[model samples]
Target: MNVRQIDPKQRGFLIVNSHPAGSAETVRRMWEQIPCRTDGSGPVVLLLGHSAGYGLATLLTGLRRHGIRGVGVAFEGAETERRTATAGWYRTAAADSLAQGAGHDFVFVNTDAFSKAGKHEVLALVEERFGKVDHLIYSLAAPRRTDPETGTVYHSVIKPLGEPYEAPALDFSGDVPKVGRVYLEPADDEERHATEQVMGGADWRLWVEALAGRGLLADGFTTVALTYIGSDLTAPIYRQGTIGGAKENLEQTAADLAAVLGDGGRAYTAVAGAAVTQASSAIPSIALYTAFLRTVLGDGFRTTVEQAGELWDQLTGAVPLVLDEQGRIRLDGWELDGQVQDRVRELWADPEAGLERARAGADWFMEQIRELYGWGVDGVDYGRPVETTVPWPTPGVSHA
Candidate 1:
């Protein structure tokens, strides 16, 4: 099967295909960004859904900065003869290559993290390979989840909670980009519950319990589930919506998990900053907000990898962990700055001017979206053909 260059195009909030070389280069560059190296003697970490985005960021930080040998679980599609693989697939492949080159012990388990079988497989691997897990980071991002026990499917929604919400949304799927108002109806009870089921802490709890039951949790074990609580500007569609309800559930779950762990063990909900991620790029409300946010922050804007490095420093005691009233790690201080919010509000109040201001950084934002799918990356010629069937170097055992 011949695999050629994929011209990633925006369709609504999703990008179409991926480029292998671009993804490898992206990972290589991210690896170079962390100049400080470790002796591969750090904690053994387990990261869920760590193919791309924040999960990937944390995984790289632990491996590069802390010299942690670890395993990552993610669900990514492989490329076929007619179509390219998912961007995350290529990214994982690239990460594996980098790890091997650096003589780091890293593995990628490509499977459904929500499945009981998948959990069992990973647990067994950990027992055989790492003996115990020092830290578990839950950063899974999926549209839906299937209960391992009952096989019930739950789908997450992004609608508001009680009332219909309308906000400025950005559209870059067409030739001419535009910013316009988008109206969304509130989520029904079923949808909200389903969203919580999919995005909440239930699965996180299960994983922790399963690990503990198997005697796989290390002494002083700790866990953190990544979350976001954006500013009021995105409250209607984000923090005050179904997603917010799910996050609340996640945080509560963290508390419960911490209680069960007892004796020096801890659990936390890490509040992360918003950025141009594959998931957020699909949400028009978030897209519009981030565009303006990038405009306002300018050189101050921190990428996901940068934030992950900070989080690693905080979590590992290299620096103090800043927690808010909720007892969760706060990494979104810059985005929530009062002065920054005031400026974003000024832009939001006037869509025309906001779009104009955001336009100056539109190239950057769009390039981010493209880079998510391994397109629009520098030092790579998109016109050249690339191998699509790049194999995952350290694929883990599959229960099925």
Candidate 2:
């Protein structure tokens, strides 16, 4: 794993896959576990938020295996132990790419692109280096935020839009997580707009315009931003909530950006399957949904890496990416299959059925959450001391 310097002051940081600490045999084991596709420079890709466990990191690795040389992200928030662990995961991906001799180079800029200045810096960095990228993959989530341009902050609400929607929520305080119908508050007009402003496609549009205006887009450049639309179980706060409105706006942005991409380049809102991530766990009712999903799908519950591999296949002409009637990419096919949803809804409908299944399988969901936080790696010895510091410079200013 390697990182490139994107700026002189170090306000931007990039961290990739890491090399081993012990014997050469250990290195070999690490490589053995990592996935590397045979050969192909698939694309020069710019990722806005490619970090571990949320799909982008694995997507980059998969593309490198298929011959994607340049990969980078204009990322934010890399200070905690969790982000550091993810940096190590990225390092492993890079190591695997090189070991396969696929000729891979990745970019990771640790800076927020929500602000006007941040977007300019990002575009400059891309224009100066990668020139024009073949694809742009953006997968990001945050709470309340404002447009840096207007200096008007908008807060994202987790509440339902019209009426309070209740669903079985995952309660984690116990030794064994339990699920029961939980009611969430409703959102007002202002709250709904706030959710859209913060979680919506406005920031995504900013990034795309920045890259495209600066002539940083390759011919047929494709861009995608990940979204989620859970079953009726999460409809209130997810599929039909204020957050869902933001997703709709995001999809609309996809349509608009697709027009701008023009020559074979398309924009898509790739709705992903349910899985635990730094972003999703914080949302209400998702943990419960994921636990039931694990019970129903078993081995079919996809991690970000697996889903990303499929996405690369679709994008690189290896396979066709099926779309919904609305034309957006439907990556959540497996999860949203009628049969699967039927069973999931059944579990939700029957309290006893849902609780029993959750009791059996909720541990998997919880463990995956721990893994996202850097707890479940094979070689990691929590008993030992490890470095938690990063070499990159951070924005010295404090957040108010």
Candidate 3:
């Protein structure tokens, strides 16, 4: 099927495409791209959350750079009220781009991961289609979820402690930049747990167990979960904060998954460097930090695509995995470089001075942010309107 010919308005089917010949060719090309390690054979890789940011980039790198043609499972809700049209559109576009670029088949599943039955369905599909999966990448970031245990749905909110905390907001309403203080309210306990359920390791563990139960995990298969360890300055709002706890749980879950994989399989937590993704933009203090980090680091920060390429290189036996003092894979080494962190510390010590420097450096930082959204990605035709169907997997939708 011609992926580019897909309809843009269709949103209820989990986009599934069959490319037997193309997928076989992709496998052959991957053999040529990946360097042989005397130790073992290459296995098929499956990627979750394969439509955005790191997940999408990883899918691209694994295919275009490593020659690994694998399946991508992206879940989209059936009802318009349950899903955002904007997100569905972007994901479909990304999936189309990936399938077209790599010449591999992609299966989109439209189901909520918060339920046990939904999880089982995805596992079944993977087993029936791929048979075995060599590598798994989990990268889901959502704001709210319904607690299966309590039967209560929680919605997340971005608020501050005590009376609404107000901060200077940038006005993009005019040609010239104007600033105003924006008020934020604090989030409640239920809201916090809902965020955790949606973003945390519960679904990750489910995916691992489901795959293993189906006997789809190849021996020595590797699974990775992306995480972060921000500085103490943002701890109250980030690391130690609500989302912070979830990230910690995710790391711990990775360790548990490793044990489950036994001696042959391994699990890694890649402490990825900060990059502007659609999800990251929603965080309160992250934009300011990212703006500052970009200003200070200039071209040092790696793009999501670059990071994914590096990750694929390491996973494919091209580069030796580097671990930090904490024993976690150091994918975000640039973020923790002593020199860089020291400068960040200096800026944190004096907010006024830091803001001055960041504002002065805004141009370079803005450019980097724009490039991250595929604005300046070389060889991409941004002017042309690309179309793809939203692969919303309804039970009645035919697989073929």
Candidate 4:
């Protein structure tokens, strides 16, 4: 199936498009590229938030590269009439594609990771089926989270920390730039806790504890979480921002999880460079930074699939470790490059420089942003009508 035709008028982030067949085909191709494991024993990988963008691409790469058989979970439902298409459909198509091509079992869980019951159900499924998972990847990024116990929902906000800062945001519909402040209502204490609860480590701990309790962790099993370390310019809006706070907590959780893994197991945090992920697009300042990063990184930039491949290699010991001066894994070294950050800071200082020294860079950056939504993508035929319906995997189907 060809990529779905996107309407030119949609303004906000377009994470989910109606492209079940295209997504399935993408997954099929990814499965073909995975190298077979030499040990003759397949790995079981559990991927959370495996529906769109980086998470989706990571799942595809893991299944393809490591010869892993596993389950994927996403909170979105199938055929929801919401602004974005249901993630359930994409997960179903992805699982079907993997099952058909790799002969591996692919299960999709349709529950929000924020809920206690949802977390429990996922653990129970893993216990009942795989018994233990070899690797766990947490790639969840949500704006708000609801406490199942308290029935209180927490909404996230993006606002200026010190003073009102005006940044250029793309008016996707008008295809023009309008200066706007990243302002939203301040989050209350409950909201902050809820956001932390939803986006933070409670669920991650639950997954690890449940699996550990069941004796599922194989010797040398690894858990990895994706994170970012944007420059100081974007730090308040990002790294130290509310979402940044959540990410910091996530990093701490990774360290804690490492201790829980004992000697044989490991937990790591990969500071991935900026890309057009579903979650990143929602942040106010990220788009501009992403555009700049794309320009500087150029065509050499890795897709989420490529990043996932690197992540899997690191986790499985296929790739040698490369540690930064700080001793953390350096997947996002390109972003932290002195020259790249200097140039970005200059652009941030003078917006007109975005128009000056980097015309090709600006154009390339904008193109990458457009391509995030499957629009202006190279080599795909947009004029062709494609089938929307693809087979969905049953909830409890097991490969083992």
Best by TM-score: 1
lDDT of 3 by residue, 91-152 (tens): 44444444454454445565666667666777677777667888888876666666666777
Task: Enumerate residue pairs that collide in model 4.
Answer: 34-64, 34-65
Model 2, residue 171: distance off in Å is 0.8
**Whole-model Cα lDDT per candidate?**
0.85, 0.65, 0.60, 0.65
How do the residues 339-386 of candidate 1 rate in per-residue lDDT, one tens digit apiece? 999998898899767888788666678788888778878999989877
Candidate 1 Cα outliers beyond 4 Å, as residue runs: 1-5, 395-400
TM-scores for the candidates: 0.96, 0.82, 0.73, 0.84
lDDT by residue (312-338, candidate 4, tens digit) is 777777888765654356677667788
Clashes of each: 0, 15, 10, 2
Q: Indicate the residue-level lDDT of 186 in model 3.
A: 59
Model 3, poorest ten-residue lDDT window? Answer: 11-20
- Across 184-250, the per-residue lDDT of candidate 2 in tens digits comes to 7798998888888888888888888777778787888888888888787777778788889999999
Instruction: Give the local distance difference test score of model 4.
Output: 0.65
Better of 1 and 3 by TM-score: 1
Query: Could you give me the TM-score of model 3 versus the true structure?
Result: 0.73
| Winner of 2 and 3 under lDDT | 2
Query: Which one wins by TM-score: 1 or 2?
Result: 1
CA displacement after TM-score superposition, residue 51 of candidate 4 (Å) = 1.4
Cα deviation of 77 in candidate 2 (Å)? 4.1
Better of 1 and 3 by lDDT: 1
> What order do candidates take by TM-score, descending?
1, 4, 2, 3
